[model samples]
Target: MSGSLTAIALDAVLEEHGLTLQQLAALCAVDHDWVSRHIEEGLLTPSQHGGEWRFSSATLLRVRRIANIERQFEALPELAALVADMQEEIDDLRRRLRRAGLE
Candidate 1:
């Protein structure tokens, strides 16, 4: 261990519009089928254009969170999605608090 560990920064391409289903699966370390199942279950949303599903950063982030929740607790995908929803709300509230100079 070191006195202070340096943070390792990762830079992503950050698709402005969105990422392809394959790209999002790679980013979330999940199989494409798993992503499709979640999407079908209404856990993840992807924009449909030209017969392809495109995922935005927000969607990608939620995918990672839901995957983590599912793995950590062996929970169902719907349960994981519920937890992710609460987390997103908390993050939004935190941002609002920061903007109001209360956090």
Candidate 2:
């Protein structure tokens, strides 16, 4: 989110498939240092594989979602809460629609 579309792509690849930090940077065509900084900043969290960082597809997707929201809102905390509420509302609506056989 703080970065660019490249960051979103990197996040997507990581989310879709488990990847190491190095692998993720490579996929994004960026430096490992950049990725490390982002991770340290709490923008990313990679799983550990034998003390090595690994990423899951879900995490990447989450990162992408976070980034997208941040880009739109410019403030992560507010956007994150808004997104959560929106998702809950959507889920509730879907449930009601299903009960009505209109889903």
Candidate 3:
């Protein structure tokens, strides 16, 4: 866990099938209803495999972030999703800059 190789291996494992709804809910400390509502509201989108929804690691992180923002500010789902979108954009931009050796 302290090494880059360990992180890479764990990421590879997670990439195999992504996370189930139950796993994502539990890990994010949110309930199934919360996740379902987000899906209904278009805040989160999960891929389907074998007729079941599967969330990627990125989705898990997004859920956690939105939950945090809602809890901290009592924001509605729409507002929270917007904030999460902005935050994700910032993160993506930072990564791009870093990759380009500009950050």
Candidate 2 weakest lDDT stretch, 10 residues: 58-67
Estimate, for each residue in 1-103, the C-alpha lDDT of model 3 and write its tens digit.
5798897786676677889999999999999999999999899999998999988878988999999999999999899999999999999999999999999
Q: How many residue pairs collide in each prediction?
A: 0, 2, 0
In TM-score terms, candidate 2 sits at: 0.45
For TM-score, the strongest prediction is 3
| lDDT of the structure predicted as candidate 1 | 0.86
**Model 1 residue pairs with clashes:** none
Best-to-worst ranking by lDDT? 3, 1, 2
Residue 71, candidate 1: C-alpha displacement in angstroms: 0.7
The window of 10 residues in a row where model 1 has the poorest summed lDDT is 3-12
Off by over 4 Å in 2: 1-17, 25-45, 81-102
Please give the ranking of all candidate structures by TM-score, highest first, separated by commas.
3, 1, 2
RMSD of each candidate relative to the true structure: 5.1, 8.7, 1.4
Compute the lDDT for candidate 2. 0.65
Q: After superposition, how far is residue 98 of candidate 2 from its true place, in Å?
A: 8.6
Better-scoring candidate (lDDT), 1 or 2:
1
Best-performing candidate as measured by lDDT: 3
